[model samples]
Target chain A: MWQKLYTWLDERLGLGDMYANLLDRPEPKGNWWNTLGSASLFLFILQGATGIFLTVYYTPSPDHAYDSITYIMNDVAFGWLIRGIHHWGASLMVLVVFIHMVRVFVTASYKYPRELTWLIGVGLLLLTLGMGFTGYLLPWHQMAYWATTVGTQIAGSVPFLGEFILKALRGGPDLSALTLQRFFSAHIWMLPALLAGLIGVHLYLIIRHGESHFPDEED
Target chain B: MSGSHLSRRDFMKAATGAVGGVITAALGIPVIGFLIAPALREDKAGAPIAVGKLEDIPVGKFHPFSFTITKVNGWERTASNYGGFILRNSEAPDDILILSSRCTHLSCTVNWNESANAFLCPCHDAKFGPEGQVLDGPPPEPLGHFEYSVDDQGVLTIVPVELKSEA
Candidate 1:
């Protein structure tokens, strides 16, 4: 019965062909280092899932934001676990992606035909940092507020355009309700959308070129 | 056309269509509901919040007032607190003016300078007079005001309206 179902679907959807062409690609001898890219991908998906669960409870305003987070931590069922995972997951994702990039760099995987993949990896790294920065401000606590103040001020210090950049980031001079709203939107929607798109391209590039092997002494 | 004449392929196709339709409806309805639920929600900003007694605000002085107003954003209902100042003219005690502490220039909370007799924005040195007029500095216009009313009990009630930067 299972074989019949599989054959029927495979005949219509070309699943057999797809599996053979895509999943059966050759790779260099697999090692622990080879798992970083997949680990980064897994962590990203975990972040997205936990983040969605969080958005159900997290209110993104200056007033209730911190209180809502506190409620999620204390009141909701398994909320502490979820929030803890998300909070730590963000840091872990960043660390993993950075290490993956470092591995790629040391292996000289960015050379030859895989330069675009390296560039996309860089974009992904930046997006991950952007996600971290924006997500940090969603809680609207004293630490988040002051950290954002200092962070945005650094952006504001950029020569002639510093003030404009600062105002753009904060949605005003000092962090206020608008700043919270802006950061929330960017964190939840804009950055995620960009990250998703870039991740798609990054994955496509990886599949297109196949995973680069560990550098051999001959080359 | 016989009652038991259904072939294996025909039976599978019928089952697939029924399952597909059911799955599609099951998934699509919730997605559509999630997309439209926010629009359908009644976004109530809550009733007018009582700040304080009218007489408590001394004449010729700007008193800071803060109140939490329940703001409904989509499905999430959260209480957002806001800050403003109640200014009474030195000579005209009856004429009470309420101004939002948020500066028009950049939305920073402006502080009332007793020495300068002006509302000073620490971010950019923008100043506004006791009457909420722009005194000097970067602010293009005066501070915005919140609509308020004094009840029979002498308590001041302010309707937390949208913060308009335009005067």
Candidate 2:
């Protein structure tokens, strides 16, 4: 009976050689800027994991947001640790990504064939910063609120489309509860999804074009 | 330094440095993060912050000190403000009074009226005497005082208390 089940499961799920082929762990080698890419990936996963745990307890409403965070910090199991990881992981993610950009730029990896990937990479970095800034405001504390207010106000400064930009960001004239909901959606769903899609395409391009040349190179 | 003679030592040293730069860039961020993450983050729910010098905070003068805590205090991210007072009262003998900046009437902050010797709340013209007593106008009570102390260094420290009436 067990043999039959194993055969049936293998036939259906097809586990044979899947991990070996799909995750062959490529030479573990790339240019100097290479490891930063992996570090960014690691931080992203950490953020996602911790963020999910936080979401379970976080309340997006103005009425309960502060209370929710307090509860998470003071009462929830290992809440502070989880919050710590999320906060630190987010910052680390951005830092690593920014360094990745710097390495690419300084090394002239943006030249020629990799320009599209570089642009997408630049876009991804901006998006990461955008995500962190918006997420920073979600807690609705004094600093978060005022800082975000300052930021959105800056966005409101853009010529011609400033009003439209603010409206799109806040979903109205002011930073109301709707703004919180909007930002929350953007942080957790919209921006993250966009980031994932962009990163996928970015990596695909990288694979297609091959890694850029290091500072000292054959080519 | 002959052009054709690249010694094994030189090649190894250069290779080590190149690899070292990459690895350092890669691991440097996480290490700094792990070490400094606590300071970069705020408690959001109100972290306990300590402010300075009870003796040095000359009467009628306020001072500024900042500590890291979460800025996400509400669902809307309100900026937290903390205030301290150094007063020489015959009865209390150089006691410290730390207060929330919120006005009693509608929660706007009350500016210290050094010239008038009071906390002046503009929202409703509420005035709090030096002792935080209700002096005049629409405010029903004093500005909220905080949990405070003079450390071994005689530096004043205070707990952040919510202003406005409990109601």
Candidate 3:
């Protein structure tokens, strides 16, 4: 009976073809370095899951942001673990993505038909940093506040368009409640959407090109 | 003759692309404005704030005074605390200097260390002299100052805008 059910679904879904195409096919003999890409993807998903859990208790406002996080840490069940994963996961994802990029570069995997993959990977790295930048202000603590002030000021130092860029970033001339609100919006919605979409394209390109062989000294 | 090669399928594709572009612009333009409206709006300056009575302040000492500025940012109103050290140069009403407590480095609050005779920032160990001059550390400029006025009733009112001191 189970065999009949499996066969019926497989016929309609082309499960056999999918298994052969997606999971079975492969190229280069990968070592530990190859695992970093998957590890980065895993961390991204982990961050998304834990971030969703956090939003249930996290209030994005100057008045309540700090208190809400306090409640999450102190009052809610397993909230510490969830937030802890998210907090540490962000750093881990950045590190993993960076190392993965380095490995690809060193192995010369970005050459030939895989150049587009490198371009998309660069976008992913930037988006990851954007996520970190926007996420840093969500806690609304002193360190976050002052750090962001300096960070935005650094952005404001662009030769000509500096003032406009600074205003666009902070939503005003100063770091007020608007800054916090906008940063929270970008952190949870805008940057993540771009990251996820680019990650999808990155993965598709990876599968299309197949993993490059570990480069040898030969021409 | 030019129109003869245009097929109905081609027309359909063009029509679909036009519709999609129109739909995108209809939603996109307003969304962009909504996100960026605050940046385009003029920043409102704070009102002149009264810190304290001028008679009570001592000469040759840094008088720490704090005031709250209620600013409406987006949908919320936030009351932010701002403070500065008022140095009365002498008993003369016009002989006064006010330095913002915010360190020039990263806006961290600075303290008037009487023993050191300078303002010390706890965040980066930046130091400023009595006249708000940058003495040591990473602050690119001196501590800012506020514009002020002494009323007939001897009330000290400050404009609250931080004027950057030239390095």
- lDDT top scorer: 3
Residues B1-167 of candidate 1 have per-residue lDDT tens digits of 57798899679779978976995575345444433434454444446878998767787667898876565443356676679888777534357889988788887888888898888999988888987899888887787888888778778888776422221
Per-residue lDDT, model 1, residue B40, is 58
- lDDT per residue for candidate 1 within A1-219, as digits (tens), equals 999999999999999788667766788776787789988987888788778878877888777899888777765556676788789999999999999988899889899899999998899999999999999988888899999999999999999999999999999888999999999899889988998998899888878889888778888
- Residue-level lDDT tens digits of model 3 in B77-141: 77778899999989999999999999989989999998998899999999999999999999999
**Real interface contacts reproduced by model 1, as a fraction:** 0.00
Per-prediction DockQ, in order?
0.02, 0.03, 0.01
Ranking 2 against 3 by TM-score, winner: 3
Whose lDDT is higher: candidate 2's or candidate 3's? 3
- TM per candidate comes to 0.57, 0.52, 0.56
The best-first sequence of candidates by lDDT reads: 3, 1, 2
Give the docking tier of candidate 2: incorrect
Model 2 lDDT tens row, A12-102: 8875555344433244345556679767876776677678768877998898888888877875556677788788888888889999888
TM accuracy, model 3: 0.56
Best by TM-score: 1
Q: State the weakest 10-residue window (summed lDDT) of model 2 chain A.
A: A19-28
Off by over 4 Å in 2: A1-32, A215-219, B1-167
